[model samples]
Target: MLHNFTYVLFKLKLIQPSQKAIRFWMDCEDTDKLEFALKHGNYKTRKLAAEALEQIAKPCSIPALLNCINDKVQNVSVACLNALERISPNDELIKTIVRKRFNWVNEIREKRAKYEANKHVKHTIYRWRRTSKESYDRVKEQLKKPIR
Candidate 1:
């Protein structure tokens, strides 16, 4: 079958590191391969894979992108964040995740509760809401100041 042939060719290209594979990872209509590359491939491959996935404009991929937010690499995290921003899902699930992240007043408390709720991760994000509130106040003061 043609699908099997395409699958074989995809696997071969991924193993061989061809430009075609990168392109397929980037621009192909297959979200499955893009998700796989984003999670398991090397940095360059994952970066391009994230970019391509962002361009696909599909809501179904946001959960995978959300998982990428916890990646250790800063660029990878940023790419995933920006991509999720681009996808802009109106679903309650995505909305809840984003709101939980950006909700300044309770962001840290909520994150702490969530992290503590999970005993797997060792480190927790601390002082985020405090620092965020301080930064917000400073920015607000600056905005209120009259330009000379």
Candidate 2:
């Protein structure tokens, strides 16, 4: 209970905790709590939660982490990928699931159009820029290869 409240305080910027402390808080075996935070928390919290999941190495986190692979926050997405790697290393099933979830070609076109249409981009909006294609290609290749 205290940990949950601490997280709320952390979310509100009322308390500044060390990474170790945050990681400790995330050490619970509850995938549901972590999943909720991953889906709803701000980028920093989401990234931290991913790191916690990585430490815990829970297979249950795979779906949530997979969905976050396209997160608008690049670092959060990377953290999710790292967690997924740790939890499901060498799993070909993950690769296929990722491929099914993302249609790179279509998503690229769509994100770009949305970015162009928006005068002020929200934190969650994703648009292709200089490294977008390259990043996508790299992620594709990584997903193709069994996690190393």
Q: Which candidate should be chosen as best, given TM-score against the real structure?
A: 2
Predicted candidate 2 versus true structure: per-residue lDDT over 5-32, tens digit per residue: 7667766767644455556666657676
> For each candidate, what TM-score against the reference?
0.51, 0.54
Q: Cα miss at 102, model 2 (Å)?
A: 13
Which residue pairs clash in candidate 2? Answer: none
Candidate 1 lDDT for residue 24: 59
Q: Which ten residues in a row have the lowest lDDT in candidate 1?
A: 13-22
- lDDT score at residue 76, model 2, on the 0-100 scale: 83
Predicted candidate 1 versus true structure: per-residue lDDT over 76-122, tens digit per residue:
76678668877986567666665654454256568878878886867
Residue 22 lDDT in candidate 1: 53
What is the C-alpha local distance difference test score of each model?
Answer: 0.70, 0.74
lDDT computed for candidate 1: 0.70
